[model samples]
Structure formats: C-alpha cells, structure tokens
Target chain A: MNIIEVRNLCYAYEDDEPALDNVSLDIAAGKTTAVLGGNGAGKSTLFLNLNGVLTPKSGTMFFEGCQVTYGKKEMLELRRKIGIVFQDPDDQLFSASVTKDISFGLMKLGLTREDIQERVDRVVRQTGIGDLVSKPTHALSFGQKKRVAIAGVLVMQPSVIILDEPTAGLDPQGVSEILHLLQEIKDSMGITVIISTHEIDLVPLYCDDVIVLDKGRVVFSGTPAQLFAEPALLRAHNLRLPRINHLMNILHNKDHLAVDTSASTISTARASIKNLVSAKENI
Target chain B: MSGIDKYAYQSKLARVNAGTKLLFTLASMAVCLSFSSVLVSTLTIAVMSAATLILGGCRLRCYIRLLMIPFAFLVTGTITIIVGRISQPTQALVSIPLLGARYGVSADSLKTGVIIFLRAFGAVTCLYFFSLNTPMNSLLSLLRRKTPGLFVELMELCYRFIFVVWEEAGKIHTAQASRLGYDGFMRSLHSMGDLVTNVFLRVFRRVDRVTAALESRGFEGNFELLAEQEESSRLLEGLAIAATMFLIIIGLLERLLT
Candidate 1:
C-alpha cells in the first residue's frame, strides 16, 4: 500500500521558477524509499510539501488513501503523522538536552507527562541513544546529534518519516550504523521511511525503492535494480550508478569478462564474476 | 561561553532542582545589591565562588580565568570613579594636575568606587554560580514556567543556535585563513568583516529553515518542556537559606561597626 501518494505536485517561488514542477511519486508503506537528486533538484521542496510546510501550488498529496489538505488543523495533524528529520541536526534540535529534543514534538501533542516520557523513553531506546538522552545537544558528536534528531521525530510516532541527506557528514562506520538502524526501524516498527541522498552507493544496500528527481521533476521511480539499470538516464539527471554496478559494467564491457553487467550489489557482482571465471578458466 | 556551558553539564550540582538554584541566585543577587557594604559584597562573592567551584565541581583554575573576564571590565570602570575631577584639592588623597585642571583620587570617591566594584563583581559571581551549575536546557525550562512564552522561546532558540552560528563563523575563519586572509592587519580586518557578514547571512537563511523544521515536528506556539523533576534536597535548601542569613547578619554587623 502506498503510504504517501503525490500526483502532479507543483510548487514555485516568488520568482516563478518552479521548485517542484509537476512532481509525482508514491511512497510504499512499511518500506524504505530513497529520493535521489542533485542540488536544486527540488528534493527539499518535495519533502516540505509532503509535510505541509510548503503549500503546493497545484496537484494533490494523499496519505493513507485520503487527499492531504493544507487547512490549519489538517496541516498540524498531517505534520504529526509525516515527520521530517532535516539534514542538519543543529537546525532541528532546538533543545540543549537530547531527551528534551526528542520530547519537543510530544510536548505539543497535549499528552500527559507520563505519556510523553514513555514515548521519549521508547524512542531513546529504539534509537539506541540511552546514554545521550542525559547529555546536552552541543556536547554530542555529529553522528550522535543525527541520531537524536531522528529520535525527536520518531517520538511522534509518525506513519512516514522523511530524512534529507541522512548520511551527508558521517564517517564510514557512522554511516553504516545509521543506515542499519534505519533499516531496523523500518523492519521492526513498520514505519515508512523516505530519505533523499546523494550517496548512490548506499541506496542499493539500504533502500528498497528508488526515486530520481531532476529539474523539479520525478525522472524515475522504481526498484533499485530497475532504476540503476538505466545508468545513462540517471547520469543525465546528474546522478550515477552505485560503485558496484559501475564496476560490473566495466568488467563486462571494457574487460570483456562475460559477467552480468546489470549486477548492482557486491554479492551479486561477486556471483556473476565467479561464474564468468569458473566457466572460462583452465589453470 | 562555551567553556562555561561545558562545565555546567559536568557540574555536580547539575542534578539539583533548577528552581532552587534559581531562587538561590536571585536571593544572593538581591542581598549583594541591597546590602551596600564591603563585608556583604565580599561575603556574596565568597559564597558564590565556593558554590560554583567546590559544590558545583567547576575547576578552580577555570573559575579564576572566567572571573578575570569581568574583572577586566570592572577595573576600567572603577578606575574612572576613583580618578576624577575634584572640586576641592583638600578632599584629594592623591592629585595630578594637567591642562590647568585637577584630577585626583579622593578618600570618599575611592571608598565608593571600591564598594561599587565589589558589588558588581559579587553579582557577577552570583550569576556565574547559576550558569556554571545549571545547564541551558534546565535554566530555560525553569524560565518557561515563570517567563512569558515568547521571551522564553526566543531565548531557548537563541541559546540553541548560538553554537551553530559560532561554529559556522569558526569554519569561515579557517577557510579565510587558509587563503592568507589574516596575513596582515588590514587583511585580517577585511577577512573578519566578511566572516561577520557571511555569518549574518547564514543566520538569516537558517531562520527560515529552522522554523520549517520546527513546524514539521508539530511545534505549535508553545514548547511543553519535558524535564524530570529534580527532587529538591532539604539539605541544599537549608544550605542556601543559611548562606542568605549569614550574609544578612554580616551586613548588619558591618553597618553597626561603622
């Protein structure tokens, strides 16, 4: 089931240059989706529209099969259900303490103190930031800050969570840890996850669905396998194939190794290369 | 500022109730201002220094360094009060004549300057005690209950984003320096000017993004701050009360002695 469906969504600034020009896509429920785009490709505008931060000039957004509205109460209710973890944790995290930052959303929800605490505690445990909850936000490392930012949104128990450039500034270990955590979140909680990233290599490993945006339009939307298959089309949109997929293409074409050029992941590439070697070798 | 903030989170007294700490600070400040005696001011400074350095677990070396910052400003202002034009040379403890005008340090003015300087320093220490013990989150959350929502929210956001701006300014400084931006005095000034403007622009843009982020997180007009109730200790309250009473007694005794 599509958790969020946008049809011909359009947004323009005062300059009349479309930020999101006739964009349309569907985010499936309980699955991980990645939105890929270059700078000024309207990825941020789309996310803002989905959260009702920006009112779309045209088209419709449907959440759980109902059309999304921009009315005051509706927008507030919509935002509670479609939380966004911004790219910069510093911008989103206004409270100095990690637990308070997580509780920021829950505080406005009119819940009892005990209820808010329970939700904050659950999210702190889920994000594995139990130790960080007591620490000040400024004292946290960048990766820790990112986790707290995500926990802030997760405390709201949103049906769909959108993360912008989730892995923009993390080390290799931090990056993998965060992605694995996100995957865990999707699997365990059944919350729909949508993230926009410039990191093409990670999309295949972490994301089930791929969305490519270019010039404020949805260039492609499909499974990672299907999207990466069109390397030329993706490059035209200023994105590239995953490193493993690019390697597979080269070994099959330039090196003439007779391996499957379509293999996009390391395991699949390894299998194809092993097949090619085993069949032809006579050492 | 950042160093003090770090010590605040690490303070042993951080676990104490913020409201109690706040009350203690405010009461101490009132005494320091109202007593108007050298003994009272000295007592205020001594008590706050001990509270911050010993009970708060702030290192004495860092505390001394932080004090020097306010000391520098107080010295200059106090010097003006001590050394000024006197109507009568008879009133002068020391006098310097320049340009047919007399400037001197008088006994009465010197006494006044010393008292004012001590009072200011005592109040500064009292505040240092509060800030060095209570983290920004706790302090702001406490203020949320007593202050108007708008002012508290503004202060909360400002406290949160100040570091963000400071960090950005730092990066800009390094980037400019790498290109010989500070090679000379004029160049350094130009680079600093650019840094400020850049930081200002970044702050302007960040305001929009921050509001959007907050709105997406279901933020309405108010932030129902979630803070665990810090059990107010009877002993701590007793200690605070005892300190205030001690200051008042000493202030009265000093007045009697004079």
Candidate 2:
C-alpha cells in the first residue's frame, strides 16, 4: 500500500513565485525513495507539504488513505507519522543539549520517562553519538550536529522519515557515515524513508526508487535503473548517472561497446564491461 | 582563537554542575541582600572575587575591569546619594565628599548606596561565574530542572530568540557597513529605522521556520527532564545544597551577633 499520496499539489510563497506546481507522487510503504532536484526546484517545498508544514495552495495529500487537513488536530497526527529532518542541523537542534533535543519530540508526544529514555538510548546507540549527549549543541563538529539532528527525529520513532539534504556540507567520511546509518535504518527497520538530496551518487546506493523534480514538477519517477536508462532525460534534469552508468555511457560511445546501462552497482558494471570486452574479442 | 582557548573560561568551570553554580550565586545574592553594612558588603565582594579566582579559574583583575565597564552607574548612583538630603547624622559621622555638592555626606545614605552597588556587583559576579563555567546547554537544562514551567519556557524562548535577533542585527550591520551607510553618527541614526524593520521581517520568517521545524518533529509543549541515567554529568548537586545551608547559618549568626 502507498504510505503517502499526493494529488495536484500547488504551493507558493506569499501567493506568488510558486515553489511546488501541480506536483503529484505516491511513496510506497517500507521502501526508500530519493527525491532528486537542484536549487529552487521545490523539492523542499514538496517535502514540507508531505509533513503538512506548509498547506498547499490547492490539492489533496493523504497518509494511509486519510486526506490530510491543515487543522491542528490533523497536523499533529500527520507530524507523528511523518518526521522531517531539516537541512540545517543548527536550526532543528534548538535545545541546549543533545539529550534535550532528542527528548524534545518524545516528551511532546507525552511519552513516559522510561519510554523517552529507551528512545534516546536506541537513537544514540544507532547514531553513535553517545558521548555527545551532555555537550552543548554549539560545541559539536558540523557532522556530529547533523547526526544529532537525525537522532532527534529518529528518537521520535516516526513511521515515515523524510530527510532534506541529509548529506549536504559533509566530508566524504561524514557522507558515508550518514549513508551507512540511513541504510542500516532502512534494512533493520521497516520504516518508510524519503530523502531529498542533490547528491545523485548516494541515491543509487540507498534508494529503492528515484523521483526527479524539475522546475517544481515531477519530471521522472521510477527505479534508479529505469531513470538512468535515459541519459538524455537525466541530462535534461541536470542529473548524472551513478559512476557505473556513466562508465557504461563512456564505454558505449567511445569504445563502441554495446552493453546494458542499467548496471547500478560497481560490481555489476565491472562484470558487464568484462562480458562486453570478451564478446568483442570473440568477434 | 583555537577551540581550546575559545572555551578556556567555560572549560575550567565545567567541573561544577550548572545547578550548583546557580544555587551558589543565589546564596551569594541572599547574603549580600541581608547585609546593610559596607564592611559586610565589601567582605562579600572579596569572597566573591576570590571564589571566581580559586573556584571558577577566572582572574579577579580581569573581571573587576569588566565590572568597571558601566562606570556611568557608579558615578550616577553616588551623585544621587549626594543630592538626596537625608540621613543627616550619619552624613556628619562619615565626612566623605558629597559628590561635588556642598551638602554634608550622609554616612547612612552613602553606606546605603555603596551597599546597593556591592549587591549589584555580587549579583553580577554570580552571573559571570555561571556563564563562564557552565555551558549554555547545561545551564539551560539546570534551569529547566530547577525553574518553574513558565520561567523555564521564557528562558528557552529567550535563548532561542537571541540567535534570531543576533542574525537580524548582524545582517543590518553588514548591509549598512557594506554601503558605508553608518560611517557617520547622524547617518547611523537614520539607518536605525531600516534596522528595526529588517529585524522584524527576518524574525517573522525565522519564527515560522522554527515553529514548523518544531511541529514536524512532534514537539509538544513541555520539555522533558533528562533521566538520571542519561545525565552522564558527574558534577555534584549535593554540594550546592550543603553550601546553601552553611551560608544560611552564617547569615543567621551574623544577624544575631550584630
């Protein structure tokens, strides 16, 4: 069943300069979806709409078959189901200490002290931020702060997790750590994950499906393999294929090798290359 | 500055719990307020200065220099003592200058003004020690734990709003400075209107974003107290209670003897 349903959504800042225009998409249950877009592409607007942070100018959004209303009662319920990790960790981590920030949501949900502690413990252990609990948010390194923000949302145990640019402004190590953590969450738990990012490289590794947003609209929606198959479409959206697919394109054009460009992983790309080269030698 | 030096003051004071430091300051204020004699106030100042140096790792001279920052208050408060023609006998007893006035010094009034100033200093030192030693987060948590609900929320909101206002002020300053708009004093005054408008607009947008962020994460109204097991901080809260008790006894003894 589709976990999230959006239909003919439109949003604008101050009733003009539309951010999301006639955008519609459905997020499947228990699957990781990566929303890809550039700056000002309304990816954030769409995500915000999903959590009902911003009421759409016109359209319907549903979670678990119930249409989402902008009312306080509905929003509170939507918020519990859809957790958002904002791009800037500094803004989301308004609490003075790591523990308070993590407990902020759970405490609001009226969870008992024991339940709150268990959630905090589980998230801190998962995010590997045990030692940073007592420290002030300002004292942390940028990556540590980002993880703390993620841990804050994770501790709430929301059903649908939406991360806005989770890996932006991170060193390679930090990016890998975040990706590894995301992968672990998806694999270990059955929670639905929707991450919006400009980093195309990470989508193939972590996402089960890709939704490409362009000029405040859904330009493409499919598996990474299906999306990468059309290099021209990828180029139109200013998106790149993963390294493996990029290699396939280079080999297909320059080396005159005919091979499937759907190889998403490095290992598959290598095997496809070996097969293509052997086939050419035999001919 | 390097990270270590940046937090040099706070890092050294980090050994004490924020709650302890707050309680100690409150105790200091109570004691200072209980005394009217200049000698007692001075002794409290001396003890406070020493405590900062010995316990808080802050230098006395540097902090005293900091206290001198609002030198205008000292000048103004003393001037008020001279003008208020009260406490005549005490004035004759203490033959100090009547702050450039021909009026005879009122020892009681001068003593009273000086006590007020010393009380101010004691309160200021307490605040300084707390800020210097305890991290903002720890202090905030301590406050959330010890303070009333309305007060805790006010403090948290204030702490959050500080960043919002800082960014607003900084942006206005930058925009003005970039255009060489505020170089002259008169021109800077003119820009104040723009500064106020900009801050309001920015604050509105930021508050909306912050509220949205809070709601999206399921933030209910109340802030939860971190569990005892989760507090990882080893600072002793018991010491604060014990010290507060000792100070109360000292205050009672001093009151009875005097």
Best by TM-score: 1
Residue A261 CA displacement from its true place in model 2, Å: 3.9
* C-alpha lDDT of residue A255 in model 1: 84
Residue B88 in candidate 2 has what lDDT?
Answer: 49
Query: Which ranges of candidate 2 are over 4 A from the true structure?
Result: A5-24, A54-75, A108-110, A138-142, A238-244, A255-283, B1-23, B59-65, B70-151, B168-196, B219-258
Candidate 1 has an fnat equal to 0.82
**Which runs in model 1 stand beyond 4 Å of their true positions?**
A255-258, A274-283, B29-41, B72-121, B249-258
Candidate 1, residue A248: lDDT: 85
Model 2 DockQ reads 0.35
What are the per-residue Cα lDDT tens digits for candidate 1 across B67-156?
A: 999999999999999999988889999999988888999999999999999999999999999989998878877877788888987887
lDDT of all predictions: 0.89, 0.75
lDDT (Cα, 0-100) at A63 in candidate 2: 93
Q: Candidate 1: give the clashing pairs.
A: none
lDDT of 2 by residue, A13-40 (tens): 8957888889899899889999998888
Q: Give residue A110's error in model 2 in angstroms.
A: 4.2
